[model samples]
Target: MASHQNLNFQGQIPGEFLIARIMQIHASISKLESLRPSKQVNILFSHLVKLCILPSSIDIKALPQEVQQMRQSLIILCARAESLLELEFATYLSKISLPLNDLNRFPYYENYVKLAKLEYGALIENTGVAQLKKVAFVGSGPMPLTSIILASQHMKSTHFDNIDIDETANNLARRIVSSDDEIEKRMKFLTSDIMEVKEKLGEYDCIILAALVGNEEEKAKILGHIRKYMKEGGVLLVRSAKGARAFLYPVVEEHELFDFKVLSIFHPTNDVINSVVLLRKSLIYT
Candidate 1:
């Protein structure tokens, strides 16, 4: 039996998805109304738990392909759970380089944790970890968990701060509340558009933009706008599905704001699909 309870906010799932599940649950219950009394009750409980728990469990992986597809849209369920696990046990795992015990608390962390344990945890075996500080996330979704995990390991502070213009992401961001100790103190969760947030964000030493825009034009526009806010000699790390070439090649030909140079290019060794591009933003000389 599946449960229809509202899941935690993580990555990209929105309230609409929850509403849809409720509708589906209602329809399923209606279907069982004509059945025998005992059968109807059993079916009701079964559907309830199936609707709720199946989407969140690791056992969903072992289920048939058809079963997985039904819940694919709700993938963010696992991501948010992982974020909580990492935050909950940061103190105990602070000494270890990659905290498997903590990460395994949630299901989505499996791939990332495996990569961290076996393949230097996506930071060149700790070099990138040493360099990270005051990390500011430009996008929120499943990536926040990964970002928070990285920040917990390396950065002095982590900010899941995005200038959300997208309604869906804004909804998810609104649901995210930080309870991870000073995480709330370090976090600047805001809902304004990017340019607007820049005014109050000051200049973060390390700014991370994870697929902040849709295409090259939007990316370029945001980058141009972002230059005004980035500190001198600071690093602006960007992750994109289109790859580093999308930003790096164009940045050279059009040096309007800050100079863009590709500092690092590496893909996450785990299950995530996007590649990481670390670009250094040269301070503008007046």
Candidate 2:
């Protein structure tokens, strides 16, 4: 187990102590038999989440080369652990009688709710669209609570297409929302990689790239694909991370999104782990 003594939020330099703490957490997570939801793993991840939100004096980009590399590895490991937890909880809920209504039972359910509210507000303000016609969420996993919450709570009249590379995830997402007729009618789960859906990309009024979708290079590729195929003026919301939270998730750089016009980039200084970048496809592509 990693020691939390150094994280006393004192005058200690963040980069120095953070590296040691990160290595400890990395070693602990690596020893886990699987990233599945277990008592030990959950405890470790909970600590990691708290560590990420701690006040840090040094920026992630200022870390040394080797430390940065290790941090990237830790980020990937954390993403996997998060995905497994979502899958495990989604699978569990799918077997229950009323899964959609009971979604708040999941530990991170409120996080998704907060994220949905943030993204919905950004879409409305940036796009000036009171109700979107069709929206596509790329990399929506087994428990697509974001899409469900957005559809049910924010945009009741909008249609959402939940796209994922894993068919099983898509099936599980379908089952999780099957009980809600309104959301079920508005939500469509499609099993296809976002890269392969170039032909149909233009149909969406908005496309959201989930935070755990890919690594830096993969996200760049997906962004390039969206820039080329998505309709002009369509909004694209890419989930990102800033400050210490970048250690938990891959950060999206503005340079990678040169083709689009950035409308808003919000970095929450709170418990919300994922920052959001709102971009509009340029009407005149260079």
- Candidate number achieving the greatest TM-score relative to the actual structure: 2
lDDT of 2 by residue, 175-274 (tens): 9999888789999999998888987999999999999888976889889988899998898999998777888898899889888889999998678889
TM-scores for the candidates: 0.47, 0.94
Clashing pairs in 2: none
Off by over 4 Å in 2: 1-13, 284-286
- lDDT against true structure, model 1: 0.45
Q: How close is candidate 1 to the true structure, as a TM-score?
A: 0.47
Q: Model 1 over residues 28-114: C-alpha lDDT tens digits?
A: 644543333355544553444333422221232244465334343222222232234434344334445444334455434654444
Which regions of candidate 1 are displaced past 4 Å?
Answer: 1-108, 111-133, 141-143, 156-162, 166-177, 242-258, 267-270, 283-286
